[model samples]
Target chain A: MISVAVDAYGGDHAPQEVIKGIEFALRENSDLFVYLVGKEGELKGFIKGFEDSFRKRINIVDAPQVVRMSDKPSQALRLKNSSMAVGINLVKEGKADAFMTAGNSGAAMALAMFTLGRIKGVSRPAIATLLPTLEGQMLMLDVGANVDCKPQHLLEFSIMGYVYAKHVAGIDNPRVAVLSNGSEPGKGNQLTLSSYDLLSKSRLNFIGNIEGDEIYKGRADVVVCDGFVGNVVLKVSESIPDLIIEFLKEEIKRSFWYKIGFLLAKPAFRVLKSKTDYSSFGGAPLLGVRGSCIISHGRSNGVAIKNAILKAVKFSKEKVNDKIESAMEGCFVLKELKGAVRT
Target chain B: MISVAVDAYGGDHAPQEVIKGIEFALRENSDLFVYLVGKEGELKGFIKGFEDSFRKRINIVDAPQVVRMSDKPSQALRLKNSSMAVGINLVKEGKADAFMTAGNSGAAMALAMFTLGRIKGVSRPAIATLLPTLEGQMLMLDVGANVDCKPQHLLEFSIMGYVYAKHVAGIDNPRVAVLSNGSEPGKGNQLTLSSYDLLSKSRLNFIGNIEGDEIYKGRADVVVCDGFVGNVVLKVSESIPDLIIEFLKEEIKRSFWYKIGFLLAKPAFRVLKSKTDYSSFGGAPLLGVRGSCIISHGRSNGVAIKNAILKAVKFSKEKVNDKIESAMEGCFVLKELKGAVRT
Candidate 1:
């Protein structure tokens, strides 16, 4: 049975939703076990609400402190007895196969790096999030981690994203492209321009540069960019559906006929919402780390948490970290080749 | 009478839409006269198709060359006899009040800088595009002008964007903000982190940092960023409706009920499209230059071209350049104070 560490006191709807998510995940996957890490007294009450069968699969690990949302990563790191740190420790101590949290993202990253550590040959770990597009879903990496990146960092991200998309996303020879201002090979600023040359020469299926407008057109399986640019793109795309709905609400209020049309078109709107919904993807995987760690949305509910647990289960089973390490070996040889070409 | 220089052979629709746009602008504003800059024979043929009364207001300048979209800005600059150059020359000689083009944006910027030059105290010019939001329209600058910008350049953009929003956009004391990964002050990469500090002490109504998602939330009247981030946001937002509509089309085709709902909600959809349409705002203005220049879409139709011409007229009449020059002076004084604080 696969074991997963769950930060039971992480998200906005913690304890309650975290307990519910554990139950939901246990129901969906029979061959799974969970170590629910949180305050013993608070979790015991919610644990009592669940059935005996679910309680049998779950084990509570006592963690006295909680990491507040506003707490800095440095402060959270000092809290050795915190729920986030204890859960990550379970993964490090071989008590769990993966760690899942919806709590302070920076803290989670810090704990993962401090505990399980980065994969061999990986300089920095990155967060990869899935975005919805017309052609289906595409993976974008460095969403909020590693704000300032060099050309080599982006090259590593492309390799890591390629491995994740291939093994986890289940695409054969995933098409990888760097996010740029224009689609042309020579386009983009300093970082993307140098990364483009490296990505093109790498062993992965690099498909040159892709413009921002082409992202939703399902152009590439994996799109690579700096964390700052990727974060902006992710946030902008996330806000589109809500902004559209808000605009439509105002438009419908203006005329009587439009109101009736909106009522009838509610199903179509539901479909659009489902396509762009975050709950379906569950969490963003902190790629390049030694162990599987999924950081979920802060506002995530039971369903989102459950989906994240399922994703963690799949990621552990895929042995993506092993593949990432090997990919970096190949990347090192390519770097040598690039150096040779320069001389 | 206000004389506007129109590039007859610039966009995909070329001399045709250019002439139609001139006709449309002339009809809209009686005080407008157009210098149709293109090959003499081609423009005269189109001008001949119009009535004698309309033809009287149109003057054709013989320019035998055209700047291809693929040509480099440097290469286009060498084409002294090109329509883009001829049109900009008209503005330089005071033969035209403002210049309008649907040509290569880089070429247009280069020509404007090469001919009219930057305003006094302005480090570099920027392109400002108006975007639709819940709180009506807001302006975003440096869309694609300077891909790599310093803290000082962004500070200049904020000043210029502030002046344009105040004068042309008609907002009193517009709320100006810098775009970052988060709304907090210390939440961006190296560039935005320094820019946040600089913008806070400027003379304009600076409102700290804003995230990408908050842009459409009607958070600020003028949003500033490096051209790269601004371009990506502009293109992504511009493509959102198309992607949504494409996704909706597939969803509607999946079921009969959805198809009917879409048909009924067609009016509401029209309202949504009109609100987000770029044609409504005419075109992006190349701000901070010595003279007014409007860069329209390459795929501009007659209506879009006409609106661009009208926008150029208003921009010139408003004397936004004069205001931009003065704004930069205020910015210089503020920079001195900042430098003094450092010492």
Candidate 2:
């Protein structure tokens, strides 16, 4: 059994939905053990409904403090170890195989860095998330971690992300790309230009630079960039679908004819909404860390929290740490290959 | 009669749809003169079907130069006395009330600045596009003009965007917001924090910072930011709906029942599509310029072009320049207020 520590207070739904999501995840993998961390009272209130065997298998660690959505990343991190941080420490101490939290992502990264520690060759750990596009879901890393990233850092992110895609996402020889303003070899900011050279020289199948518009085109399986731009892209990817839906609703509401028409399209609307759902995919995996930790949205539901734990369970079994280490062991051979071609 | 210069070879459709759009605009306003700029051969081929009255109204300026979308912004501006440049020069020369193009936006901004200087107190101009949200269309500025902008530049963009929203979009006391990572007093990057202070101090009804998700919530009528974020938002806003539409299409194609159901809900789909229609709003307006210049989509049709021209006509008569100059005159007051607040 790959035991995982889950912060029950991390998400908006908190212990209630998070516990329920854990229940669902437990159903999928009967051998999975969850370490629920939060306020004893809140955690107990939700845990009361489960059976004795389930209760026996599940565990709780008291953590009264909470980090709010309004708190600064650094300020939140400084608090005397919230349930999320404590849960991460459990993984670092080898009490759990992996760590999961439907909590503040910034805090998650900080805790992972402080407790679990960064990989040997990795500069800063990156948080990658899956984007369900027209073709299929692709991996986009450094989504909101490490805003000011070096070119070498991006190369490592690409390697780690490439491995995740190949093993976890079942993508064979994933097409890795350095996200940029354009697809040209010489395109993008200074950071991306140098990263492009490193990526092109690597043994990993390196695609040329991918543009923002073509991100969803499914041209590249693994797309990498710094946190700032990546965060914008990630946020935009989520927001635009919502904007479209709202605009459609408003346009329909303006006229009676459109209102009646909207009712007919309800099923299709549900289907469209379903495609954008990332909750089932669990939280973002903090790669290049010694231990496994999946960071979910703070406002996540029971299922999303559960999915995060499920991802943690997978991370433990898949040997993500070993894979990331192996990927980083080599010098960017792709860089040498890339230098051969004209810029 | 508001005479405007229309670059005939400006967009993807160019002379053909642009001329048709011009005709559509002329249909609404009988007294309109257009100086069509393009290659003589291409211009003749496009205008062949129009009547002599239409022919008489439009003065064709034969220029053997064509501006490409891929051309660098610097190169487009440096094309010493090119057709696009010459057309813009007409606006600067006071021969036209406004200029319209659907071509390279970078080149357009470069030429607009070099040819027609910024308003006196305005430090920089921004591209303000109408976003079709549930609360009706909101004006979003700096879509693509300035790449890396300072807080001062964003503040100027906000004021100009506010004017465009209030005067052209007809929003009385438009609620303006600076897009940020969060909706708080002290949130987002350094640029937003500084811009927030400047905007809050202004007479324009400045709402505080808004998160990316709140965009669909209709939190404000004018969302201002630097061009990089603005362009990313705009492009994402354009792409996501199509992505959803594609998903729905494939889903419906799975079975005959789904296909039949889709047929029933065709009207609803149309309603949703109309909500996200960038064309309904036509091109974005280039604010802080001496003259009204509309930048339409490269993929715009004659109808969209016509609507764009009509919108430009409103700005031209609204005496946007007069209002902007008056706003700029108050810069000294604002600077003094900022100083007072600091002390």
Candidate 3:
């Protein structure tokens, strides 16, 4: 049975959705167990409300403090007994196979770095977000982990993204590319230019630089960039569909014929929304840490939380950390790249 | 009457679209004149095809060479008699009110900076692109002019974007925001972190940091970032609708009902397409240069080229360059930020 620890007092929905998600996960996967890490008194009554047989599988651990969404990562770190900290400790102590949280993302990353630490040869841990493409989904890394990253950090992100795409997503050979203004190998800022050289020499299937317009056209399975660019790309892409729909609504309201057309095309719009929904992917994995860590959105609901739990379970079963550690050992250039910080 | 010099031997459509665009512009606007800059032998026959009344207003200026899209800006600069160079010279020599090109953007920007120079205190010239929002269009600057930029460069972009938004876009008290990972002032990488500080103290209608997801929500009238981030955001946003349509077509094919739905909603999709189309905006203006220079896409068509010519006429009539030069003079902080190159 795979064991998972979840931060009960995390996310906008919090204990309500987190509790529903755990119940759903347990019902969906019979061989899975969970440790609810949060305020014991508050959560005990919630768990007791479920079926007696389901209640037997859940163990509530007391984490008196709660990390508010507004709190900074540094402030959250000071709360050693908080749900975010205690949940990470569960994975670090080997009491749980994986840790899942929808709590403060910066706090989660900070706690993971402080407690579980980096996997053997990994230089920087990155957040790998699964973005939908025309054909399927692509993996974009360093989403917000390290905003300012060195070329070597990007090389490591590419490697980690390659491994996760191969193992988790099951692509035979993932096509990897660095994001740039132009598609040419020489067309990029300083960070991408250096990362391009490192990626070219690596064992992975590294394609030349990819322009932003080619990202969703299914040009590459893995797109690597520093966290700053990656974050902007992810957020901008997320915002477009909503913006388009808003514009379409206004256009429809202008004409009686357009409103009728919108009604007829409701099914097609539903399919589009479902395909782009983040809840389908569950959550993004925080790669390069010693323990398995899955970080979901702050506003994530029950379904999103459930998917995140499943992703964590998959991460544990695949031994992704072991594979990453082994992959890092083979990266000969990382030795020289150590402590190379580029502002 | 505003006279606009257009590079005839530019873009994929070349003299065909360029000539067609000139005809369209002349037909639309009665008070406009154009100097068709390219090889006289190739363009004279094209101009002769127009009506005698229309032909009377068009003049052909012979530029012996054409700047290829692949040619380096430095290499293109050597050809002083090329269409790109001669067109810029028309504006610099006061022969034409504005210079417009659908040719090499890099070459156009380089020639503009070389010939026109900066607008007094301006450290680096920027390209301001009009991106569609739910309400209307917003201005995003430094699209690809400078790949790497300091905080001061971003500050200058904000000021220029504000002036353009107020004068050209006709927005009263335009809200300006710097692009960052989060909406908070302190939440960003080193570049944005420092930029946030400078922007907060600027005289412009500075709204705090804006996340990428909020860019198209009409959260701010002007969004500021380094050229690298701006280019990626622009290109990625441009590519998304195509990807969405491709996916929708595939989804539609999966069922007969979906196809029917797609057919009914064709009008709404058409409206959406027109709103997002780059051709509607014509071209991005290279701001902060001494003279008004408009750069269109290499793949721009007849309609796009025509719109670019119209945009150049508007830029010239607005005296945007003069306003920018005056704006730069009031910026007291720019003196210290003159040579601040981060990378």
Give each prediction's DockQ, rounded to 2 decimals: 0.63, 0.40, 0.67
Residue B183 displacement (Å), model 1: 1.7
Candidate closest to the true structure, highest lDDT: 3
TM-score of chain A of each: 0.94, 0.90, 0.93
What's the CA error at residue B169 for candidate 3, in Å? 1.7
Pairs of residues at least 3 apart in sequence or in different chains that clash in candidate 2: A17-A302, A201-A333, A201-A334, A201-A335, A202-A334
In terms of docking quality, model 2 is acceptable
Per-residue lDDT over B127-201 for candidate 1, one digit per residue giving the tens place of the 0 to 100 score: 999988878888998888788888878887888888888888889999998888777665788999998887777
Give the winner by DockQ: 3
Q: lDDT of each model, Cα atoms only? A: 0.85, 0.77, 0.86
Off by over 4 Å in 2: A148-153, A178-206, A246-265, A331-343, B184-187, B197-204, B331-333, B337-343
Give the CA lDDT, 0 to 100, for residue A246 in model 1: 92
Report the candidate with higher TM-score, 2 versus 3: 3
Second chain alone, TM-score for each candidate: 0.94, 0.92, 0.94
lDDT of 3 by residue, A256-325 (tens): 7667767766777788987887777889999999999999977788999999999999999999988877
- Candidate 2 lDDT over A173-278, as tens digits, reads 8898887654656445667888887776678789888877777878899999877667667766677777676666655667665565556556776777767876
Q: How well is each residue in B311-337 modelled by candidate 2, as lDDT tens digits?
A: 777778888877767765664236655
Off by over 4 Å in 1: A12-20, A66-76, A331-343, B12-16, B46-48, B331-343
- Give the 10-residue window scoring lowest on summed lDDT in candidate 2 chain A: A334-343
What is the C-alpha interface RMSD of model 1? 1.5
